[model samples]
Target chain A: MPTTLRDEAAIAGIGQTPYSKNSGVSELALACQAVRGAIADAGIEPREVDGLVTFLMDSSDEVEVARSVGLGDLSLLSRVAYGGGAAVPIVQQAAMAVATGVCRHVVVYRALNGRSGQRMGQGVSGDIITSDLIHWSWYMPFGMLTPASWVAMAATRYMHEYGDCADALAQVAVVTRNHAQNNPAAAFYGKPLSLEEYYNSRWICEPLRLFDCCQETDGGCALLITSPERARDLQQRPAVIRGVSQASFDGQEQMTSFYRPDMHRLPEMERAGETAYAQSGLGPADMDAAILYDAFTPEVLMQLEAFGFCGPGEGADFVRDGALAAGGRLPTNTHGGLLSEAYIHGVNGVAEAVRLIRGVSHNQPERCEHVLVSSGVGVPTGALILGRDNG
Target chain B: MLTPEQKQDLETQIRAFVGRPTGPPSVGRDLVNEPMIRQWCDAIGDANPVYLDPEAAARSVHGGIVAPPMMLQAWILEGWSMHRGHGEPRDEQQRLHKILTDAGYTGVLGTDTEQTFTRYLRPGDQVSAETVIADISEEKATGVGVGYFITTRTTFCDAKGIELGTMNFRVLKFIPKEAPQSAAANADAADAQPQKPTRIKPPLSHDNAWWWRAVAEGTLLPLQRCAQCQKLRHPPRPMCDDCGATQWDHIAASGRGALHSYTVIHHPRFPGYEFPILAALVDLPEGCRIVSNVVDCEPGALRIGMALQAFIHEDEDGFKLPLFRPAEPA
Candidate 1:
C-alpha cells in the first residue's frame, strides 16, 4: 500500500571522526569534520547542499554547519528528537528532498562528548528542581534517579515472563563485542566479552548488569543522501535507501514507564516496525543483515519479537538458535554496537547497515543487501532499509 | 534544637530525597505543604498575587490558593512522629517526617506528575492534602549498599482531598533479612584533578552579570534567570530543559540555596587541573534546577543539599564564578 522510503533515495556518502573519550574538540568542530567528510565522500561540493537533519540534543546549528562545510543557501532543513534515531532518517530526509526537487544534497551529523562532556548518569541534578520533575521528584526523593534503574524495571518484568532473559540479553552484548573485536573503529574494538563476564559485570540497576547498558562515548558520525544518479557521480558507492519510518507509542513517558500495563511489550516499536516493514515490502525473511539499536540487551530480544523475527515469547529461543549472529539467520550490530562499539547514538548503527549493504563492513557477510537499521528501544524510535541499487 | 540522634535522622532522611533508595521503610513526602509551595513560588520568582495575597483568594476559580503543579510539596507520613530520634532538635520538622512514615501508608510514595498552569500561585488558601498510592514494586536499590525497597506512585489532591495530580515516589522497606548499610563512608579516593578550564570569555551573560555576581563566585558564570520555566534554572536552557515545557519566566535568583549532592573528582571530565575541588549540586532556595560543582569545600564534607548562600569564586581566568556556601537556613 505504501512505497518504501528506500526506492525513493540513496545514501551517497558517509563520514566520521574516530570515537573517543577526550576528543578535545568542540561540538562544532566535530560536526564540521563529519559534514565535510560526508560531502567529500559523496563527491558533492558543499555548496550544492540544501538540507540537514541532526539530533535535538546536538549543539551545532544548521547555519553553523552550513558555513563550516561551506554550503550555500539551504532550502530544506530539520531536527529530529529522541537521540540516535536520526541516523538513517537523515538519508531519508535527503532522499525526500531529491524526490521533491527541493534540495539536492542533505547531510546529517551528531558530535558530542557524551561521556567526557555531558554525563547522563551524573544523577538528577537539573531536572529535579522543576515541577515537571515532580513525578520523578517522588522517585528522586527515594533515589531512583538514573535511566538504567528505570530500564531495569522493564527488564525485571521480561525476566519474569521468560526464566532466562539474562542469557538472551547477554547474547546481544557478546555478539556486539564479537564484532567490535574485529572492527578497529569501535571504542571496544579488540576487547572481547563472555557471558560470564556479562552477568558478572557491576550492577547499575537491578536486573541490568553494567554490560547490559549502553556506554557513553565521545564521537561524531555523519551521512550524505541524494538521488541515485547524483550518487553515481559521487566519490563513493551509494547505498540505496530502501524504506524508512519512525514511531512513538501510547503509554510512552521518557525512559521511565514503570506503571505500564505490561513492561515486556514494547508497542511503540511494533507500531514503527509494522509501518516500516510494509513500506520496505521486506519482512524478516528478506533482511540479510540487521543493525538494530542495542542500547540495552533486553531491548534486542524485545525488538526481535516486535519485528516478527520470532513470535512473542519466542525471541529468547530465536536468539539462542543463533538466528541473530554473524553466521546465523540475521547478522546484527556487526559494527559492534552501542553496547560494544562506541555509542555515537543510534546513528553508528545506520553507518554499519549502509556498510553492510555496500559490502564493506569489517564483519561483512556473504551476499548481504537488505540491511535493517533501527533507533533506540523503548523511546520513540525509527528504522530504515538500505539495499544495493539492484535496479 | 533537637537531640543529636534527631539531627542525624533528619540528615539521613533528607539524604534519601531524590535518587532511588536500595533498602526499606525510608520516608519521603506525599504532597505539597503550604511552606514548600511558598518557597517554590518565591524561588521561581513568580510575583503573581495568587501566591502572595491570601485575601485576594477565596474569589478564584479552583477556590483556594491552589499551588502551580510545579510547586515542591514537603512530604510527610502519618504516625512517623513517634520515631525515637525525635529526642533531637528541629522538633516540628522531625515530627512531620515521622507522621508521614507511620500513617496507614505503607511504602506510600510519589508517582509521576504533570503540570499545566491554569493560573499563577498566590499565598494562603484553605490548604490541605490528599494522597493515594499505587504501583507497588519490590526491588533492590542502586548506589550505596544493597537492600530491597518498595516504590509506589502517589497522587496529591486539595483539601476536600480532591485529586489535583500525581507523583510516583519509591520507598525501600528492608525485608527482614536485608539490612542496608547505616552510614556510608565518603568516597575515599582523593579527587584526581579538574580539567583545564575552558577559557570562556569574561561576562558570559547575555543578560545582567552584575546582579548574579552579587550572589556568587568568579568563573562560576553569572546565574542568569531564565525567562522560561518561571524559576531560577541554570546552565541556561533555551527551553525548560527538564520537561521541554516552554512557558518561561526569567527571574534573578535570590542567591540562596542548599547543597543537594556533592562529589570531589579524582579526574576532570575535561582535561588538566591539579587538585580536586568540591563539586556540589546546589538546591537553590529559588525553585527549579540544582547546578553542578559550585567549587570550594573539602570534597567529603559537602552534605546533601546543604543550606547555601551564593558567592563568587575566581578561577585562573579573569571571569567570575557563581558558587554557593552553607547559607543560614530559611
Candidate 2:
C-alpha cells in the first residue's frame, strides 16, 4: 500500500510583489523579486534551494529563475499545466520533492504581468496554434470569447438550479473586499465593496456583475518548501502541509466544460477536496478558514459546496449574515482573494493559506488551525490542507 | 451609375417590400428519414449512438432517431431537379433581385443566418416554411463590393400546424468593386479606407478538419464514434476515450435540444459580433451538448429547459457555422 504524504513537508515562507494592474517591471524581474523575498523569509542562503516548480503557463524559465535568484543546482525542476489550476499542484510538486529527499529545499513560484501584458480577460487571439485551439473553435465564432463568458455559461445554469443566487455571489465579493480593507498588500485595500455596490455594478456577462470578476492583476507570489524536520530549524514557524492533491476528472475540457450532466458543479474540486481530506485525516469541520479560488464569485459558491463546507445548493445560505467575515465560523479569503487581492493565477491564495496557518495574516481569524486553499474552479483543479505546526 | 434620385427611387421600391411575404409557404417534398440523418452524421462525423442506434435511442433522452437541428433549412431546400430556370422572376424575392440587377447591383452573396427550432424532428415528420422580407441596410462599402444588405425571416412549421422554428437570413446585393470600369477610377479609393475586421476563424487541424469541412458544407453536424465501444464524442479527436480504439466513425446529430445553461456577454465585445451575444450550452436529444449562439430571442425569454434547434449560418465571407434559436409555439 502507498503511504500518505501528509505532514511530510512544510511551507517555510511565503512572499510576493505588490498586486498591481501594471507592474512596470518585467515578469522575470517580478519572479526573481518574489523568490528572493521567499528565500530571505525562509532565513536560508540562496544556494540552499535545490528545486524549482511553477506553472507551464509561466513565462519565467526554471534555469533563468534559478540564475536570477541564485538558486543552486536544481534536482527537481518542474511545471504544472492548467494555468489558474496549477497553484496547489506547484506546491505539491515541491513538497513531494522535499519529502522524497530528491531536493532539500524547493521553491515554487508564479509570475505574470497579467493585466499590463497578455491579459487573460481578452478573447482568444487568432494567431496561436495550440491544443486548446480546437475546442475554442466551437464557441469562439459565436462570441464566447473571454474567461467571464466561459464561466458564465455554467454560472447561468447554477442560478437556474439554485434560483438566482446573485445576493450570495455578491456576499463573496463584499466579504473578500471587506477583508482587503486592512491588508495594504491587497489592490482593493482602501476600496471596500458594499452589497449594494456589488448589485449596482455593470454586468460583464449576465448573472456575473463586474465586481463578480477577479482583478486582472500584475504581480508574482512564491513559497519555499522543505521537510517538517528541516522547517523546524527555520526562522519562522512552518505551516505544515497536512495534505495536498491535484484532480482532473474524466471528460474535462480546459475551461469551457459545459457539457457535463451537471454544468453547475465542480467535480474536479470535489475529487481534490476528498483526496486532500482523506490524506490529512480531516474533514470540512476541521478547517478553521479557507481560501477558495475567487477568480469569479460564482466559483467561490460552487467551491463552498464541493469542499463540503455547505450542502449542495446551500452555499448561498452558508455565506449569509457575514459568515465569511473575520469572526465567522469559517473566515475565507481573509486576504481579499483574487477578487480584491492579486491574481497571481492563485499562487497568492496559497501564500495567504500559509499566512493563516502561521497566525500572521492581516485578516487573521481567531481560531485558525487548518486552512483549506483551493485553485481555480471550472477546470482541472487542486486543493491543499495546511495546518499550524503542533511541535 | 444611378443618380441620387434613381438610388433613392430604388431604395423606396425595395423598402416597400419590407414586412411583406416574400413567397407562399413551401412544403418539403419528403418526410424526415434516417438516411439523411445518417448522411449528415457521416459528412459531419457525429456518432452519438442515440442518433444512429434505435436500441440506444430507446434508452436515450430523445427516445428515437431524429434529424439534426442544423438540417432545419435543409428539409425545406428546393432540390436541384426543381430549379426554376433563368426565366421570369418567380416571387417577391426574385422580383427584388431582378430590380437590384437592373439597377447595376449585379453581385449577390449570402451573408449570415440565424435559425431557431422549437423541437427535434423524428422520422416521418414533414416540414413547411414561410418567408418574409425582414430588413434592408443602407448602401455601404464592403471588401468585395459596394452593396445593400437584405435580410429575410422564415418561419418553419410541422404538418400538424404547430410552429416549429424560424430563421433570419441576410444577403448582400452589390456591384463588384473590381469591375473594369470601377478599377481604374477607384483604385486608390478602396486602398485609402481602413479594412474592416473579419470574424475570428476557427483553427483547423488534422484531427478536426473534417468536422469544420462538414459544417462549411451546411448540411450536417457530425459526432465521432468509437468503432469498438461505440461511444460518441464531439469537437472531434483521433482516439476514443472509452475503448481507446484508434478506429472510429461518425453520425449526424439531431440538433434538437433543450437549453442547459447560457451566458449573455456584455463586456469586452469582440469585433464583427453583436453585443449581448446569447451563448448557450444546449443538450441535444442524442445525448450530447454543444456550445452555440442562441439567436433571435431576448435574453429575458431564455429558460434552462427551453427547446431549441440548430441551423447553419453562412456569413458574408462564406464562413459557415452552426447557431441556434428558440422553438416558438404556433
Candidate 3:
C-alpha cells in the first residue's frame, strides 16, 4: 500500500533443481530439495528460515517441507492460489512478512511433477481444485478443456480484432527459444525453434500451435527473501525488491473470464502492473528488461500490452526484430521463460528477473536497471519489479 | 482380481450381445411441436428466431420451424415409465448390464457421448429410436474403481423410417471403492479413466444450486438480479459486486445474446466430446455473459459479434446444460 514493501525486502538467493520431464520423486521431495538449495545459496543455516510460503496448488505442506528440510520454527506460513498467477504474490507475502518483523528469512517456492504427474495442459477433468471446478465446469463440458484452449479463446478474439498475429506470436516463441540456447538449465537449451518450425508445428488449439504452449515440465524453484540489512551481509549480491503487487480485478474467473466486457486483454495483469509501478515510482520506460510469463505465446503479446510495453493491439509490432532477444529492446525472458525453460509454474521466471538485476544472467542485457516480472495472465495475476542493490 | 482366463471368458460372453438390439424401437410420446421447442429455448436461454417465429422460420434455410438437432434424443426418451422402473428391462443390452452387475462392478458412471445429426426435424415429425449394444471393453483399473467401459449406439428415425441422427453413448460399470486408499490406488492406477470423458458435472454450491436446479427443471433460464441496485449477474454469486447487496431475486432471460468471443479447439482431445469444438462467450441482453458451446455453425462462420440463441440440452445421463447457436436471420 504506499510503497510499504518497496525496497523493504530483497531476494538474497535463488535456487532450482534441474528442469526435467520426470523428477522420479514426490512433489514434496522436490520442494524440500529446492528449499535446502535456497538456504545454502543464501549462506544461512536451515534454522534461520523462519517463514515459508508457496502456492495453494503446491502438493507440499509448509510444515512437511520445513520439517524435511530441517527449518526452524516458522513464524509465517502462507499460500496463494490461481496457478502461476501466485508466482509474484508468494514473493509479496514473504516481503510483507520480512517488513513486519514476522520472520527473518522467508522461503518462497514452487515445485511440481507437472509432466510425470498431473499435467496442467491435460485440463481439469478429475482435478478437484474446488475453486476452479465451478467456473471450469461451464467450459469443460463444451471441450474448452486445457489452459491452451482457454487462452485461445482470447487469442482468437485478439486475432479477430488485429488481423493475423502469427508473425508476432512466432516472435515471442522464437526469441525465448533463442535465449534458451545460451542457458543449459533451460528445457529447450539445445533445441532452437525457427520461425519456419513454429509455423509448421501442429495446432494444440487453433491460433495456438504446439510450439506456442509452454512445456509441461517437472522441477522445483525457490527464492530466499529477507530484510535489506540482512541481504547486504549475505553471500550473493541481493536483488532488492523495488516493488511487488498482486491484484484480482472485477469480472475475474480462474482462466475462463469470458464474461468480461473485453475478453482479449488481461485486466488483472494490467491492474497488477499499475500497482507495482506506482509503488516503485517507475514506468515502462524505466524497465531495462522483463521476464513476462510465456505459458502461451498469445499471452506474451497480451502481457506486453497489459504492462504498457506497447499500445493496445500494437504488441505484434513491439515484439518484432528481436525486440525480446538479448540485444534488443526490453530483453525479456532471458532464461527462456516457461516456453523454453522448465515450467516451474512462473517462479523460475522470478529467478530470471533477479538474475537480470544481479547482472548474472547468461543472456544479460548491457544495461540492466529495473526489470519487470509477470506471472500467468488470463487470471487474477501479479507483477514484480526488482533492481540492482545500490546500497 | 480375476485371472486372465476368467476375464477372457467374461469378454467372450459380453461380445456375443454386441450385434443384438436392445429392444423394439421406442416412439416419442408426442410429435415434434413449437411449444416444446419454445420451452427448450427459454430453459436454455436460446432466442433463435427460427425456433420461435414462423415468419423468420419460413425465410430461413429450414423453410419452417425446426427443432434443435441436439434435442434428437430428448424426443424418444421414455418419461415417467423409465424413471419409475415400470418399463421392465427385457433387451439384450439389459441382460449384458445384468451380467456385469452380477459381477462385482455395480456402480455406474456415464462417461461420454458422440452424436451425429443427419438433419433437423420439423413440426409433425414422430421420432423413434432403436438402440444396440455397440461394444464392451476388458476389465481395467480407473481412478474411480476397476471397471469395464460399455458403449451403446442408438439410431433415431422419423415415422417414415428416414434416419434422423445417431448417438453413441459410453458408460463405465465399476466397483465403487468403499474408501479412498490413494497411496495403494496410486501405485496401480492406469491413466484416470477419462478414456471416455464425461462432462465434468458443475459443483452445486449453496449460492448457485438454486440456479442449476431451475435449469434442471427445464423451463426457464434464471438470472440473479440484485434487489438493491437492480443489476443482473451471472454465475449466481451471493453478493452483487456492483452494489454489495446480498438480497437478490431471479429474472427469466429472453434467451437472446451475441457472440462476444470464441475458439475452435483442435487438440488435447477429451472423451465425451466431438473435435474442433466451437466454444464461445455470449453477451446476453441482461448485460452478463455466459460461456457455452456454439452449435449449428462452422468455425469459419463465427464472427465476434454474431447474434446467438440459447437452448437446453439434456444428455443421456440427465445432466441439463445451456448451449448456444447462431440466431436465425431477423
Number of the top DockQ candidate = 2
Q: Give the higher-TM-score candidate: 1 or 3.
A: 3
User: Considering summed lDDT, which 10 consecutive residues are worst modelled in model 2 chain B?
Assistant: B184-193
Candidate 3 Cα outliers beyond 4 Å, as residue runs: A1-3, A126-132, B1-197
For candidate 3, the TM-score is 0.74
Ranking by TM-score: 3, 2, 1
Worst 10 residues of 3 chain B by lDDT: B186-195
DockQ, every prediction: 0.02, 0.52, 0.38
TM-scores for all predictions: 0.55, 0.74, 0.74
Query: Local distance difference test, per candidate?
Result: 0.63, 0.86, 0.86
Task: Give the per-residue lDDT digits (tens) of candidate 3, residues A16-133.
Answer: 9988999999999899889998899889999999999999999999999988999989999999988999999999999999998898999999999999999999887654545456
lDDT of 1 by residue, B150-238 (tens): 33344444445445445454444222121222321111111112123332222323233343444343223344454534444454444
Whichever of 1 and 3 has more lDDT, that candidate is 3
Expressed as tens digits, the lDDT of each residue in B1-330 for candidate 3 is 567897777778888888788889999998998999999898988899989999999999989899988889989877775544312345777677666655656556788999999988999999999998888887787866798898999999999999999999998877765432354332222222322345667666667678778888874467899999999888778888888999999888988998887888888766567778888878888888877888889988998889999889887778888888889999
Interface RMSD of 1: 12.6
